[model samples]
Target: MGFLDGIRASKSQSNNKSKPPNNHFVAKDIVFNVDYLEKRFSDCSDIVFRKIKSNHKTNKDTIVLVFTDGLVEGMSINDGIIKQINLYSQIYNSKKINIDLLQNLLLVNEINRSNNFDEIIENILSGNTALFLEGSDEALILNTRGWESRAVEESSVESVIRGSKDAFVENIRTNTALIRRKLKDPNLKVKDLKVGSRSNTSIAVVYIGDITNQQLLNYVVNKLEEIEIDGIFDSGYIEQLLEENTYSLFPQMQVTERPDKVCANLLEGRMAILVDGSPDALILPIGFIQLFQSPGDYYERLVFANFVRLIRFFGFIIATTFPAIYVAITTFHQEILPTDFVLDIAKSRVEVPFPPIIEVLLMEGTIELLREASDRLPIKIGQTIGIVGAIVIGDAAVRANIVSPTMVVVIAITVIGSYIFPHFSTSYTMRFIRIPMILMAATFGAFGIIITWTWLIYHLCSLNSFGFAYLSPFAPSNLVDMKDAAIRAPLFGLKTRPIPTPKGKKSRK
Candidate 1:
């Protein structure tokens, strides 16, 4: 048989109904006369009949038929739907059990809304049942959209030491509500968009209507509209689709779980998008400095916050360049080393046959492998793997002369520094960029390092997160926003938002 015939035959067999004359009959079948639907699906087990009693004894003549199962348990029908319907009937007793009256009561615009096919199929599948009557062409679309969901829990990956313990859950509405609950301003608007062609995932773009730029809002909406994917399971999907520079190692958008962090961004005039299934929300108009700033910073004293921020900045620098510096110094800048230190290094590397680059690569690769293995294992087991692997491999490799002891130290320090970054995405991006830096350092020493830095800066300058530069408050150097970027000055001191975003967003009150 042909394709249309084959599809019709399969649907007929599955539904146990004779195929209508036209190829496009099934859709129209639900649209035709209400009696045909009633007769075809009348005795279905999921169907129920609820009638109105005029007096103490039942009035069978003026009965309202609800083709759903009984409202109790062990039955497929829902109690809530029945309760709501009965409540409505008691309130509106004048509008008795009739087709037009029920239709009007249910606010159904047309006759097809209460048809037997749509009511029985839609309501039953949604855990309610079909509602039909002797003469009505319409049925009430009962709200039985019930499904179980998990409660919000603290974020395992982005936990803070001093900040709020509340984190996001899988529910987008709940997540948005959490933000709304915290910031009870009418101007804080959530624009919902149905993303993912298949998943139809509910995504909400949240921002302060007055504070956020209208141009930026339109840009973001246009970008979202351009996305034609089958599924967007996480915020990362939007990040990937909307990022200005996809090839750059640096992240253009910042994804976080904490509502406080998202709120902070919104106050800075940045837009936040929360996806239905993912706990993480993507914050647009993010800069390079944002990844370095943590939620704990604002929750602590300025002195301690500044000290911690400085440490993180240093950590990122050390993480990116420590191994490369080791390779460069050992291979090309040996003359710059102190006499005793040079002798010690020479002694350490004497037994190693491979060059310093090769030695560094070996140790770096081993550290990366250990890190990956540790991350993939369970918490307890992952800790064990990290400890055992670091000790056994670092000690064994050093003793075996597979890599120099100093090189092992550099690689370990690099790995630790990468972990110290506040945002996981930034840390991951830094981890990836490290290899290229190492290669460049090995090829051309300090000059190679300089070239890499210059190239990175160029890329950063080119990168934009929903029209706002990724290097904002640094490249443009906004003195006003600088207080909150490099260091958490004081809660009161942050009187203005990041300058790259729309102005007047930040507040002292």
Candidate 2:
């Protein structure tokens, strides 16, 4: 059979099987519940089940506390719950203990009551203690979550000279608290949702209810609800699924580690998504120009920030087109260069064996390897490795006549230009586009470069992020929004939010 036919047959067979129904009803009998739970968690050694028996005035009562081994707080379980229960039994002389009065016995701050067995199991897995009484069908979920996590430290990737040093940690609650501490408005809302069928990862969607567009909010929430993945390890997974176009290389969502950045975006009527295990939070409805912006832009003086913004734009152009332009000029349009420069380039290439395209590809590939090595290595050693590898490789290549010295310079400048991008993803996207640009330049020279650029521009114009145009203020030509696009207008001069905001809510007041 053909490959397609085999795939179809396999899918059909898989679809024909009868799926088992979920048996998650809570039983009134504690013994039956315990047996079911024991059977469900038979092979799991980390799940702890502690049973306590209380005898008060000839009446015997039993309670089972379920929690994960290292996830729950030790003191909360030992002293707060167990010790308190024993103390209450000894002090209060009652024949029958009421299940409703159990809340007063436990010393926990946050206690919730639920009768769903599935919810009880979920709470236990999420580092909470679940108490199942002998007579009652309900279970009490205690907030006993306590796990070791890295402390909030300064962001390494998006470091700023003059700004808050605190960055988001892996814990979702801590990340939300960081943003809450910044934006104290009552309208700021945080809604929780669960994604990933197997992983059951918790995600928080945060936004200001007063200023945000209701339709945009609904779009984001619906998109998140539609995710049917088995596991979501990081925010990147949700970002990809939430994208309007999965095939596009450009990211529709902006991921940031800084709480300040998230707060700024939220204040502007954008939504922020925080996943439980990822420090990176995603900001939705982002435009292309916003990706080039840095949190430090608003922190610095307007004049200096504007100058830096201009430099970044220039770097973007150079990183994307410098190598391609050089290849097209040297191979197809040598007459464009001055007499001295042309003679110098020709002299450099005299001993080289490969053509311009091969030379460019080889050098670019070597630089990429060095970058990956540097990134993967230890901090101190990575810097040393990057410097040594570049010097040794470039010098050796020129000496061996494997590539021209001019080509080495062009590749080095291209790498530097790519690094100037504040966002690593944007830098990566630029790096990826270079390959096609190089191939086009090698095949059709100047014409190919022009056509490739025109196609890229058209694609950008057509793209959207959460129903908002990706290249807003440039494609649709909104002059009012351009104040913060390519240039950094003074803080006082800027009074309105950018494009794609809620209707009748344009001013930043």
Best by TM-score: 2
| lDDT per residue (tens digit) for residues 1-509 in model 1 | 74223333444555433334533212222212233444555667655434443221222113233443433232223234344346665676555455445445542222235434533554444344344442343455544333456688888878888878889998787899899988999999999887766666778999999888889899898889889999888888898998877887877788898999999888778789998878999887888888888888888888998899999999989988888888888889988989899999999889989998898778878877888899999989999999998999899998888888888878878888888877676787887778888999999998889999999898888787776767877877677767777776677787876765555655741
Instruction: Give candidate 1's error at residue 458 in angstroms.
Output: 1.7
Residue ranges of candidate 1 with Cα displaced over 4 Å: 1-77, 84-143, 504-506
Clashing pairs in 2: none
lDDT per residue as tens, model 2, 1-509: 84223333544555443322444766555655676777888998999988765545432367779899988889999898888877877877565565777887788989999877788888888999999876677788999999888999999889989889999999999999999999898999999999998888999999999878889999889989999999998999998888878988788999899999999888778889999999999998898998889989899998988899999999988999999999999999999999999999999999898999999999999999999999999999999999998999999999999999999999999999998877677888889889999999999999999999999999999999988889998988988888888996788767777766665565441
TM-score of each: 0.80, 0.93
How many clashes would you count in candidate 2?
A: 0
Off by over 4 Å in 2: 1-23, 56-59, 506-509
